[model samples]
Target: MPSVTIHTTQNVSIDCETARIGTRIGAWLIDAVVLLVAYLVVLYTAEQFGSGFNREVALRLGPIFWAVLYFFVSEWLGSGRTVGKRLLHLRVIRLDGEELTPADHLTRALFLLPDVLFTAGTLALLFITTGGRSQRLGDIVARTVVIQDDPAADLSLADVLTIRNREQHRARYPAVQRLAEADMLTVQECLLRYRRYRNAAHREAVQLAGARLAGLLGIDPEEAAADAEQFLETLLLDYIVLTR
Candidate 1:
């Protein structure tokens, strides 16, 4: 699968796998099935209302409005996931390693008409397959990419065991709560990359992430500089202990 390495301002480089065409197709099909079922339900409910102006509006315009609303609201509230995306563990994220704004979602949603609906997905498929980053028209316009998440890769049995022990442990950094979920995910990715590669770049990623996080958490410079790796690990543990 194609992957992109996003370098954060903190200097942590995280590799994210692009969603495969097959997986994207599956998600689209699932979303289509959901829309079909919803349309059917709407049609059935409309029949109960009998022939009238309201019925005409409901039959003619309701589905269009609902479909638009569904995509917009789902991505916005679900943090870049629709029903299909959530089930498939695919999320839309900015290429710049920043959180996606509402404008980004709106741009993608607007472009979907030409990218998928009007062209019957031909344009999207073409761009995704031919483009280096597997981005469609909407993705290109919005500067976003669809990334696949591997839960097993992110958290191993050992990590889970450690988390279980953290339930009763006091947090070392209460300020870790100031960070968002995305920040913690980046920290986790940096740690994983360093563990797997153990090269200069990956090691720098860990060190940079640790220093950045320590600064963010208001940790003493001497303490954080003493052991960057340990500081990052402790922050991760503190996050789990405080949040979950």
Candidate 2:
């Protein structure tokens, strides 16, 4: 199976599986069921309170309006998680790893009209099955992707380091803030290997990576080689803070 690796603001590289088409359909069904239940309850209430409006019209239109409202509000407030997504351990996030804004959620919900409601989900199905990133039309437009939050294996000791000391890192190596996200991911992987393996090959690889990064940032080679782990950690922290 394919996976999408997201570099978090905390300097953690998480490999989240792209949700498959079948899994996305399952999530949609679960949400549909929830909407059905809500529709029944709301329709019942409206039948009693909506004196001037036609009950049949209310019954027909109320659910659609409520469903749209629910999806929009819930996705935004829940940080791209609906009840179905929460149940299935699925989440929507930006391809660049930033959190979704209210506009992003609204765009996604509004596009559901074309992607799911009108086309019977065929458009969404086609896009997700072929898109490779598990993107629907809305996701593509909103720069978002859905990921399955499955438990990860092969964690390294470097993964244990908390990258919250951004100020300290920036104070030490301000130039590291110029590193790109891809470059930061590379540094992260090397640090993880350095922490996980006690072998000479791993140490040498880390040393080489540290030297190259030091040159890129114009840091003194001797200083970077003296404490490669600390240099890499500080670089990762600077990248995370600046990018975030």
Candidate 3:
């Protein structure tokens, strides 16, 4: 139940569950197995071309070289995913939920030596459990965190306008085409607020939304304000029907 609340640039705070240490270690193990397979293939292919002792050394060193290159390029170009992270539904992202650039990926991958390799991830485990935001040394240095990507629920404009007088509402405000998609979404949220709470804030939101939408569609603001909740519902229905 450990979570980190991230404050985005747009001033929205989102609470996200931190990826558990076990999950992260599992992902790393999966990637390591894949890399091991790839390394064996490379060594077997090279062994066919060289002599005994020299071939033995090439088999040892060549895969390490390829693994380093592979990790760097995959992490960078794959946008902070290796095959394992993708399968585990884990992604590396900035603290603000923004996408990481190649430089950010490179920085984290390069710090793997101290954070993961020499210490068998002892340092990473210490940092993540104690660093407050589930950060490993690489994540701390790169301003990133590994998050489990949970799917969000979807809502449609039509879905928000469900009411008894939907047909009548649609008929009353046929000019809903004047509202853009974003405006329609705002209206949908306002209608939901009005329906759920009917508090001062919710009522005020509906009133404001109804007035603005009425203005956009060339309706009288006085009429819109008088019956703001009904007006907003009608506008939402009109938008849903007209847009479809």
Query: Against the true structure, whose TM-score is highest?
Result: 2
Which TM-score value belongs to model 2?
0.65
The TM-score values for the models, in the order shown, are 0.63, 0.65, 0.58
Q: How should the candidates be ordered by lDDT, best one leading? A: 1, 2, 3
Looking at model 3, report the run of 10 residues with the lowest lDDT sum: 152-161
> Which lDDT tens digits does candidate 1 get at residues 1-244?
6998765434334577889899899888888788879877877876886465376777677756666666777888988888898899788887776677889988888777788877889999999999999999999999989888655454432243334445456788899999997898787777766665668888777777778878877888776678776777778768777776
Which residue pairs collide, candidate 1?
Answer: none
Off by over 4 Å in 1: 50-64, 153-232, 235-244
lDDT of 3: 0.69
* lDDT scores of the candidates, listed in order: 0.76, 0.74, 0.69
Judged by lDDT, which candidate is best? 1
RMSD of 2: 7.0
Better of 1 and 3 by lDDT: 1
Per-residue lDDT of candidate 3, residues 128-158 (tens digit): 9888888999899999888765423122211
lDDT tens digits, residues 42-138, model 2?
Answer: 7777677867757777766776687677888888887677888878867787776656788898889988878988898999988888887879999
Model 1 RMSD in angstroms: 9.2
